[model samples]
Target chain A: MAARHTRNIVDRPIWKSKGEASTVSFSAFAFLFSELIQYSQTKVKSTAELENRLEVAGGEIGRRLLELLTYREKAPKRKTRLLDLLKFVHTTVWPYMFGKTADSLEQANAADDEYMISDVNLALTKYISVPRDMGSFNPGALAAGIVKGILDAAGFPARVSTHYVDVPGLSKPQTTILMKFEPSVMQREARLEPRAT
Target chain B: MALIYSLYIINKSGGLIFHKDFAPISRVDLNDSLRLASIWHSLNAISVQLSPVPSCTGIELLEAETFNLHSFQSVTGTKFVLVVDPRASSVPAFLQRVYQLYTDYVLKNPFYEVEMPIRCELFDAHIEAAVQKYPMMS
Candidate 1:
C-alpha cells in the first residue's frame, strides 16, 4: 500500500519561512549577555553558586525549547535509547545553536557510564574573548550549563561540563563537554535495560 | 560566488570571529567590519539582551547598503550572528527563522553554549536560502 497523501502532511511547514533573512549586530548580543552574566553574578557568592544560577538560566531555555521542538516531532514519536537521545541533542540540537553539530562524540574505553561529546568550536567564546581578570569564570562554562540543562530536562541526567581544550587556529578554544552519569542514572539504565542478552 | 558582503562577529572584548554573506554582493572590508564589530560588541551586548525579556540580546539585525547583520542571544548568553543581503525583503523573517532555528537546534543541542557565536551549519544553510533570494548587484 502507498503512504497517506494528506495535504496537511505533505504541506507541513517547518520552522523556516519565506521572508528575507533577519540581521543584527554581534555587538548587540555580546554586551547584553555580558551584563546578564554580571547581574546574575550578583545573585551568588560562591563560584558554584554563580555557575548554578547560570545553569538554572539555561534550564529555562532547555525546558521551553524541548517543548517547542518535541511538539514538532509529536507524531510518530520514535522510541529513543539513552544513547540515541544523546545523539539527538548532538545532531539536531547542537546545529540549531552553532549552525552545526558537535565536532565528535566518544565513549570512555575505561569507564562504562562515561560519554564524551566534543565540539572543537563552541560558539560562546568564538567572538567575545573572556578576559583574564575573571578568574575561574569561563564564559564557555555557561554553554556547558546550557547543555546540562537540556540533558537533564530530557531525562538524561548526566554531569556535563565545558572545558577550553586546545585547538590549533580557532582561538575560541574547542570545548570538550564531558558528560558523567550519576549512580541513579546508571541504576535506571540497568532497570530499563532490555534483556536482549 | 561573489562577495555577499558578510557581517562580522566580534567578542565582547573585540575580535574577528565569524563571517558569512547570504547573497553575492559588493566588496567588504573583513578587517574593518571585524574591528567595528568588536568595538561595538560591548555596547550591543549590554543593550540587546535586555529586550522584552532580559535574555534576548545578541546581533539583532545588520541592514545597510549591502548586507544586514543580525544576532540571537541565547539564554546562557551565547550569540548567533547572521549576515544577509541588504536588499532581501525577508530579512526580518530570516532573523525570526534563525531564532526559530536557535530555539529548535542550538538551544536544544546539548553541545551549544548560550550567547555564543553561531557555528551551526544548519542555521547557516537556512540563512543562506533566506537571504539568497536577493538580487545580485550589477
Candidate 2:
C-alpha cells in the first residue's frame, strides 16, 4: 500500500496537486496575454473592438475559474448579495488570479448602482505599453471581463468596464474596473437585504 | 480492444462543434455525426421538458447493448457526449478533464470563436492524449 501510494504521488501531474495553489510564471502569462491582444488587434478594425475581444476571451476564463475556485474553497458558498459578490472579486478572485488584492473597492457617489475596483499595477497590464494612437485603450479590459463574468455568473448582472484613473502620488495610473449593476440586480439585492438580517 | 467509441461536442444552440471517432468500429462521416449531435441535442431538451422535477438536467447516461453514452453539460449549455464501452470506468473523470482541455486550448485560443467548430490543433492533440490515458476495462 505504501509503495502504491508513493507511486501515485510520483506519477501525479503538477496541476493535479490537491488543495495547493497552482500558478504559471508571470512571463509565460504575459507572453500569452500579449499575443491574445495582438491577435485581437488583427481581427478587429478599432481599438474598442480589440478590447471587446479580449474581454470576451477573459470572460470565458472567468466563468470557468468561478466554478474551479469556488470548488477549491474550503467551505464553498455562493455569494448571493451584491456586496458579498463584489468583496469576493476584490479579495478572493483578485489575489487568486493576479497574485495580489485590489487597491480599493468604492461605491461611486454619482450613482447608486455603480462601483469601482482599482488595482495599482494590474498584472495583465504590467508589461503592456499601449501605443499613443490607441488612446485610452486599456488591456485591463480583460480583467474587467473577468469581473463581469464572475458577477454575471453569480446572478448579479453588471456591465463592467475598464478605465485608466490617474491617482495622485502614483507613478502610473491605476486600472479601475467600473461595475454598474442592472436594475434587476439592485432590486434583488434590496429584496435579499431585508430578509438576511 | 477499443473501450471508447467516439466523442461529440455540441454548442448551446444545438450545433455540432466537434466530433471524433476513437475506434474503427464506430466511425461516422461528418454529416452523420452532425445530424446525430442535433438529434441528441433535441432529445436532451425533450428529456428536460418531460422531467417531473424542477431544474432537471437532461439525459445523462444511455445504455445500449454494445456501448454506453455518457453526456455532460456545462453551466453555459455546451454538451460533451462520450461513447464508451458498457463496462468502462471513470468516464465522468475523463469527461471533466476533456472539459478542462476545451477551456484551456479552445476557449483560450484567440483565433477560436465562441459557439463555432473547434479547430484547435492543440485541443485535438490533448484530447487524443486524454483518450489514451483513460482506463478502459476489456
Q: Which has the greatest lDDT?
A: 2
Expressed as tens digits, the lDDT of each residue in B38-128 for candidate 2 is 9999999999999998899899999999889999999999999999998888888888998988877676554567899988665887899
Docking class of 2: incorrect
Candidate 1 wrongly placed segments (more than 4 Å): A1-27, A74-80, A167-172, A194-197, B1-138
Every model's TM-score? 0.49, 0.54
lDDT of 2 by residue, A1-197 (tens): 34534655558553434445657887678658867776777889998898899889878878887887787666789877888778888888988887778999999999999999998888777645565577898889999998888888888888989999999998678999999999999888788776644
> How do the residues B1-138 of candidate 1 rate in per-residue lDDT, one tens digit apiece?
423445444444555545665434554676766666665667676665656676445546656775566665545444446565555454455555655644554444333355466575444555566455544555
List the DockQ of the predictions in order.
0.03, 0.01
lDDT of each: 0.60, 0.84
Q: Which regions of candidate 2 deviate over 4 angstroms?
A: A1-19, A195-197, B1-138
Q: Reference contacts recovered by each candidate, as fractions?
A: 0.00, 0.00
Cα deviation at B121, candidate 1, in Å, is 27
In candidate 2, the residue pairs with backbone N, CA or C atoms under 3 Å apart (3 or more residues apart, or in different chains) clash, namely: none
